[model samples]
Target: MTGSTVGGQLAEELQEIRERSGLSLAALASRTPYSKSSWERYLNGKKPVPRQAVDALCALTGTSAGRLLALWELADAEWSGRARPVSAPKEPQVPDRPAPSPAPPTAAARAGVRWWTVAAAVAGVTAACLAVLAFVGGSPDEQARTATEPPVRNHGCRADTCEGKSAVAMGCGAAGMITTLATHTASDGRRLELRHAKLCHAVWVRATGLMPGDRVELSLPAGRTQSVTAEGSLDAGRYLATPMASGDSRTSTRICLDVPDRHPECFTG
Candidate 1:
């Protein structure tokens, strides 16, 4: 198999594990040495993920790394120019999945290492993403629940003092602080959350994920509002926040989004 093929398989396994854990990519990165950007690339198959990174994810979620290790070994071999012909442990059981590329000419090179390792983990690792109704697939029917963030640390600023300052930097909206007062998602899939730190008497807008042209805003009772626009690719897939505001955002304040090609949408908790 080609490196890209193996990398893609590994990526899928990682993404599934991530989703099941109910932790956002940001959370995964925060708990591990890897940066959010690194997780983005690793999960998206844009770069070669380190073998040890899997260990870190397993550590955070309390999952055994055995199965993921199998996929990684296959990916590592391809990246290192060592390709094998055998299907990933029982991959033959599901002849229905489409492959990314054709296999190599022969399966002769170091067969022992790949087979032994693959057999140990392949039994249950890939079946969720690739078999029959239950053999190699997962339940996709359940609606995806919003991933909650941890509480924001004490920002030590409230009301007037927090106005016009980054809620995250001030340690307010960056963390869940409290559970989301309200949440909204644009038709195009950009997400928004109203986060509050009651002790600080502050509330802010946290757009969990944004695109190039997305805009985020939070408003207070007296026509006060703060907004920021998404900039470049670096900003893409990143969390963006608005300055802090006061009052019961659950009812009084309005949170809105201006996304490309869609009508502006607003929500209040």
Candidate 2:
């Protein structure tokens, strides 16, 4: 089967394990070193599952890693196309000649020695390939131990220094920008800024002066929209949305604060 097919199967198995464990994606993320978003991608087969992640899941679900690792091996082999064996080249034919009388070791003996050397070289290469495969497959216990370790954080920016920086600049991804497209004030006097990051190719809404129960919604082109509610009475929050398509020509994006009869606000570029 193709690598993608195998990967999808693996993803399904992981999803099933998560469901059987009665853990939500967020809960799974909390138990593991991955974030909820990372789990989403993995379960959906949108990204390759890491060995560490597999170990984490197996540990969390009390499942043996043998079966899962076998599936992963199949998928990985297919994806890398390295499972296919290479055929050795055929030896060139030589014309038949009368056998020479037995003599001291000569050029032919040297050629035989060289052929043995080539054979040894091929064996070494094959051994190296096996070693690589074994390493890539990894040990279940090692992976489980790694999963128990704390998640690594980006040292470039902490919560205090993340503001005003593009997600990529903050180590999120390669595609990101810190430029603001426009800014507007909601009817409730809350400031809303339309920010665009080129690398992410997506737009974000930053709202300040928000209350604990306030709800913010973003309306984008092609009828796409997303909404989030404020938490813990934070005065400022940022929400990122799906990547904007290149064909979208809307001059402005809309934001609505859901309060008792408050109108939506627009931030024009």
Q: Could you tell me how far off, in angstroms, the CA of residue 38 lies in candidate 1 after the best superposition?
A: 30
Q: Write the per-residue lDDT of candidate 1 for residues 187-234, one digit (tens) a residue.
A: 667888887777667777778678888888777777889887888776
Leading candidate by lDDT: 1
lDDT of each: 0.66, 0.59
Model 2, 43-130: lDDT tens per residue? 8888777655776677557576678988887766644554566765445565887668876558989689769867977898878867
Per-model TM against the reference: 0.42, 0.33
Instruction: Estimate candidate 1's alpha-carbon lDDT, on a 0 to 1 scale.
Output: 0.66
RMSD of each: 15.7, 16.7
Off by over 4 Å in 1: 1-154, 173-176, 249-251
**Clash list (residue pairs), candidate 1:** 127-136, 131-136, 151-177, 152-177, 250-269, 251-269
